[model samples]
Target: MSAAGPSLIEFVAKRPWLKKALTPLASWYGNAAGYRQLGLRADDLIPEDNERNLQALSRLPPKEAYDRIYRIRRATQLSLQQKILPRNEWTKPEEDTPYLSPIIERLAAEEKERDQLDTLGVLKKH
Candidate 1:
């Protein structure tokens, strides 16, 4: 963090290839004792309370540098078609990459079906 906002580590700014390995940490440090006591799972994205910095940081991205951002953006776009999500509200563990597609598809399908039923004539008993 600096006068402007959370500055990207020099590693990220200088080395494009390192993007694959970089992860965005929600906090500045993890206290191992506290972490062990709390049993923290690693993959988490805190909501950006400082939305201005988030907006600025968006432009600095080597686009796919943050998988969570990429996934969230995709989900938001898909939600427009399916109506399954609010714009910024992403699934917990939003970067659970291997399972995200299936989860999104299932939810979106359910939402679409519900919307369809709302438009179509109702079922009496069946």
Candidate 2:
């Protein structure tokens, strides 16, 4: 499982009406979370204390890694000053795309597969 825990994204997505109904709620929740005001993407809020996230961070492209670091540092600075980015400078909805999440999910899947393989047993021919 991902550090974020099991997600209902796939479940919601499979049903168009449910996804449509939840779209505004999700947007409102995202905005209310306030990370965008700090100029940070949702992915940046993910804790890096775990091995999977750390590995995923390491796999990010050079530009993406650099941008993530810059955003985090800037957010830290802004937080210390207790200020949010100007409205114009806040991260737009489109800009809040997931960069690290796919990698984390892939890593989790690989780990699960590895565990399954390691636990497999073969019977000897009689």
Candidate 3:
């Protein structure tokens, strides 16, 4: 956005554990944005923790940023299949997963299902 996009160090200072959780997303975003420099250094993002998530957002390429979004999309699907998240949330997948496509279609059996009503409504044991 700016000459200096986002400071990774500043970002991780508040949100620790982000690096570990979002490594896949960060790396992919960096790559997709066509960013030349990942700028990923353990010390850059985290001063005290010394383990910031990744690198310089500003130096990164646009392609890398895009890739990052895609990764997050994929991660979202995996979360659904694990049942950590629900399928209804995926009005459209962030990215498709091999496992979820067929099952998502089955939801089309009824309009209500396709409409993606609240889980309590769908699963309530009348």
Candidate 4:
């Protein structure tokens, strides 16, 4: 929800016709993004240094956290070597789900709620 820029996804998603027409385009764009070739999921491409993402990463289940770290390190090493993973090692589309996005969205919502509560005004009348 807290994207760095305006998202056309939400708009398109709300319209069934638009979503139907754009599904293939979106899939193609995801493939073209090239992270899958590096064996990384879309969530793995999110900047980990940011506060929200860091919190989300911390909240991940242990196995998920380990997998995320493994993928990131693998990607880093591959980038350094200027080599893509062998075809068999590439991330399959089904495996490229946004595992961390929901947690990040929850964290953002919690932060917003906390802000609201912290700023609440108290009124007393007798």
Clashes of each: 0, 0, 17, 0
lDDT of 3 by residue, 22-47 (tens): 76886676445421222222212222
lDDT of 4 by residue, 1-126 (tens): 575666687898789999999889989998899999999999888887788888898899999999988999999999999999998988998988888989988998999999999999999998
The C-alpha lDDT values of all candidates are 0.44, 0.94, 0.40, 0.89
Task: Give the deviation of candidate 3 from the true structure as CA RMSD.
Answer: 20.7
Model 3 stretches with alpha carbons more than 4 Å out: 1-55, 83-126
| Over 4 Å off, model 2 | none
lDDT string for model 2 (1-126, tens) is: 346678897899999999999999999999999999999999899889989999999999999999999999999999999999999999999999999999998998999999999999998999
Better of 1 and 3 by lDDT: 1
Task: List per-candidate RMSD values in Å.
Answer: 20.2, 1.3, 20.7, 1.6
Scored by Cα lDDT, where does model 3 land?
0.40
lDDT of 1 by residue, 57-120 (tens): 4434364336556655665566456544342453334433332223333544666789998899
Best by lDDT: 2
Q: After superposition, how far is residue 38 of candidate 4 from its true place, in Å?
A: 0.9
Output the lDDT of residue 39, model 4: 94
Worst ten in a row by lDDT for model 4: 1-10
TM-score against native, each model: 0.22, 0.92, 0.22, 0.90
Residue 20, candidate 1: Cα error in Å is 35
